[model samples]
Target: MKKQSLVKGAFVLTLAAFITKVLVFSNSIVLSRVLGPEGIGLKKMVMPFMGLMMTLTTIGLPVAISRLVAEADAQGNRGKVKKILVISLVITGSLSIFVVSLSIFSGKYLSSFFLTDPRSYNSFMAMIPIIPIGAVSGVLKGYFRGRQTMNPIAFAQVFEQIVRVCLTYILVQRLVPLGIEYAAAGAVLCSVLGEACSLIFFIVMFKISHHRKMKISRPSWSQAFRGKNVLIELLQTGLPTTGNGFVISITRAVQPIVITKSLALAGVSSALITKQYGMLTGFVMPLLFLPGFINQSLGATLVPAISEANAQNNLRLIKRRLNQAIRVALIVGVPSTLLLYLYAHELMTAVYHAPTAAPLLKLIAPFFLLNYLQSPLQSVLVGMGQAKTAMFNNILARCTNVALIYPLASNPLLGINGVILAISVGVILETILHYSSVVKSIGYALDIPNIIKILVAGIAMGYIGRALFINLNNLTSQGGATLILLTGIVFSIFIYMLLLFFLKVINGSDIVRIPFVGKMLGKIFPK
Candidate 1:
């Protein structure tokens, strides 16, 4: 089988992710308006718990499946691929069933204690069915990703988002007259149907694909199930990945509870607490993560790509890919950080209709750039079979966050700002650790000079663009402010590229490194 180029795969996935993010962002905007802050807060509060349940059900099998399948595909072992899929499905499916049962049985206790909002009880219960449906879709996604066939995975994601946005909007609007809790429950219910839609799409795509007709003999239950080897391999790879996920999910699940409880103890009212939580999670964090879709797409493509290269013991290929991934991350992430820092207020007001999100967004913008880079570095570590090291680093970060969050959030002077500080500190620390681990594993030196150059270029572009926006803002009304900001953003990107060329941070050679546009750029920026 011919391998897909990393850039091509990343581009495809990035396009899909961009669309998905837009749709989801739109859904969030509509839902926020329909449900209001309290309703949105109710949903956000249960998200961490739902994420924890998902982590428990998946047990990181998706990563393991992708890595194992990539290795098997590299070796042309079709039967092994089939067996790996079978084993993974059996394991995750059973775990999913267990999780759903547990959630249904423990909903009341979870709502009363962990959530502290009895109104969130129905939303918590609504997440039960999503676990199993999402688990099945996740496995299929990993399978397609491992095969380096990103189209199906891309299609499934976009399709899922479409279904989710439409359903969530419809349900939330219909249920809003009942109560905010019912509306929140409607939003959660959308997740279940969305996953089911994606799963069905994957199954249909898989059935029609050429791989389904491959002439490999199916492994009997005895042959596939008899050996501890497959189970051991799965556990070895999946456990550490799952451990990382489990720790993060635990912290996430605890964060809202900690924040609300701490704020309440600090004399903040319950309603205000929920509204504040909604602003942070629903508004500010989304803006901080806007550039993440690019890195996430790159990271998703990196795993199977790196795994395949590692399996072949191609050290040079691994180093080259790592360098490319880091450079691309910096190129995109640095400008994003600067843009968000400069335009936080404008963006918040424009996208979320929440001017209050500006302060938190500005506070976290620079640190969030490190968070963006962490995604690819962690992916590289997992791809290089250093998942245990990655897991340890993540656990340390989460533990640190948990230890400090209450103290910071409960402090009268700090409050929610303290929570943001804790998060920023955690992200920076984790990124450094992940980067160090990747360096140690690969024995490749990162290009710090180039990174510095990118940062310089980004800062220069941000100031210049800010000046232009300020001049333009005087001429535009509130109705056209978003358009002007968007126009400025476009100009900012162009200015960044121009500065990159002028500063020699990016030249014809760098331009030629891009996927589809490389040839066009080469012609335009001849060395």
Candidate 2:
């Protein structure tokens, strides 16, 4: 397999991500409409625990394996690469089995003790087997990434999402007739099967690719056990990388517990509480985070590009990339923030048929421009070898988030709105800390005038789009609400771009990246 260049690989991964996100979003819409918010809540109730279990299962092995394998492969030490794989598999494999076992035996006890809804036991058990399969898959994905082979990994991702969504929808439809619990459990079971399929795909690809490239003599169990140096190297690289995810997963696991307990104390019924939780996570979050695809795609470009620049001690280049990253993030973020804020009700109703989530969406929308920038800023930090700084900052913010959930949510007046407040504030804190760290480290000043211009452009576009939508809303039939909403958002984003282009907020290079017309536009546009 020929390795892809950095740009080509990012393109492959970004395209795959776009496809998978679409599938995931469509799946969410279907589930929300079919199983309703409470069903989503039930499925989501186990997801945090699953995330924590997965974090423990991998234990930084995949990242470790990626780094170690790349180093060994670069040095032409095939034997060391093989050893790294075996050790990582051994470490993660054992952890996976342990997680699977723990979940199996303790499923009832856990759901009863930890969850506010003990009825989630079925969904919990249904998702247990996925731990082992997903852990192995992560290791393989790391191997592929280490080798710079994006195609197979990209294919496997899209394949798994397609399989998961289609299977889950079919299964949920069949099981919803029984009960929401059954539907949720069936959805989880389908996810497990989908992961199994991805693992199998990875295994086949690895075998074929590995055998064709080079033959490796199988090491004895004693030889594998003797890789003390390899284990240390893997642990050293993997642990620090794992820290960020560890914090995130732990915080996620803490959320439902805190919010549910608090809401229950406020005399909110369990069912309504679940529905509200479902509305927030399943509906509101997916929509808000949809625009993050831009940040993620650009962030991928930033890490390697900035990392290379830093290695050369080219501070000027680093400054340029950092500013460009922030600019791009805001370029996507501002319009997205306004779209969600201005059309929250129409969007919620049109997309998910869950209008009740609109308020949460509206409340959180204003703060999300900063939220979207976190990824790009964090990428810059990672490029500068300041990942731990970013991690600790995230830890502090999440701690604040968790601390606020209980106190605010337990107040009947605040309720789930309080939960949104907690989340938005945490996002603000994290992004601000990230921005300040980058600016302080690089002595980089943002393009204040350009940023102001972009903000003014975005604000102007937002009000115009809202007025257009309202006018069209009165003219359009009720059945065409989805179409109208979709059209409105697309036109609004286009308008925002035009405003930027006219205001000179974005330059020729920005327009030059568009697919077909970028060159023509760039040639015509001024610097």
TM-score of each: 0.83, 0.75
- TM-score for predicted model 1 compared with the true structure: 0.83
Alpha carbon lDDT of each predicted model: 0.83, 0.80
Per-residue lDDT for 187-238 in model 2, tens only?
8888889889899998889878844555334434465569988887777656
lDDT computed for candidate 1? 0.83
In candidate 1, which residue pairs clash? none
Which runs in model 2 stand beyond 4 Å of their true positions?
A: 1-11, 25-49, 63-87, 100-129, 146-149, 165-189, 203-233, 240-243, 256-283, 293-324, 349-360, 383-385, 405-419, 439-453, 473-482, 501-527
Residue 487, model 1, lDDT: 85
- lDDT of model 1 at position 293: 81
Best by TM-score: 1
